[model samples]
Target: MISSTPTTVTDRDFATEVLSANQPVLVYFWASWCGPCRLMSPILDKLAAEYGDHLKIVKMEVDPNPESVAVYQVEGVPAFRLFKAGEVVESSEGAISQQKLQSLIAPHLAAPN
Candidate 1:
């Protein structure tokens, strides 16, 4: 099991937790029935634990949170969106390698402030 304490985001909590976050936020848009989403869950959990302080990893169930999906234009499951200072800086869809995920997040990790 993944040991990271990933925040579960919903329609009610999206703006406060993600858009208004002080630190960078990694939002994973997923659905329970999506196979790839299930596969990436463990990896996301690991990332959350490893980068707990510098980043906030959140998981949103697309079916229940359509507003977020519409706002972010999430067309598929297992979508990953990185937000910095309340704006979406990067996004990815479908399955992705752990290395790619790390690479995409490297810049935010390197931000001085």
Candidate 2:
């Protein structure tokens, strides 16, 4: 089974863990000091549990992962990018509600077996 917990990624392993993932990957760009990011984590954790079999949720701290931040154009905290087939298919910035976040990825998730 896929993990129910959100995985952490780094610039060094981003390509392998996210870009090359077999399923769609939701990449969350956040920082330690960002309150909004902290608020968003629980929502992500919930989604990770619900969608783990069909999707991969990953977190990348922007402060320590500058290469990924610059490459992905993440200029602010609480940015999200959904990668499918090795390319980004959806993206969002700033605070987002759980419903909106689900809608953003629902269309991309695999159907239940």
Per-candidate Cα lDDT values, in order, are: 0.89, 0.95
**TM-scores for the candidates:** 0.92, 0.97
Clashes of 1: 0
Clashing pairs in 2: none
C-alpha lDDT of candidate 2 relative to the true structure: 0.95
Question: To one decimal, what is the Cα RMSD in angstroms of model 1 from the true structure?
Answer: 3.1
Model 1 poorest 10 in a row by lDDT: 1-10
TM-score of 2: 0.97
**Model 1 segments more than 4 A misplaced:** 1-3, 111-113
lDDT of 2 by residue, 23-83 (tens): 9999999999999999999999999999998999999999989998998899788999999
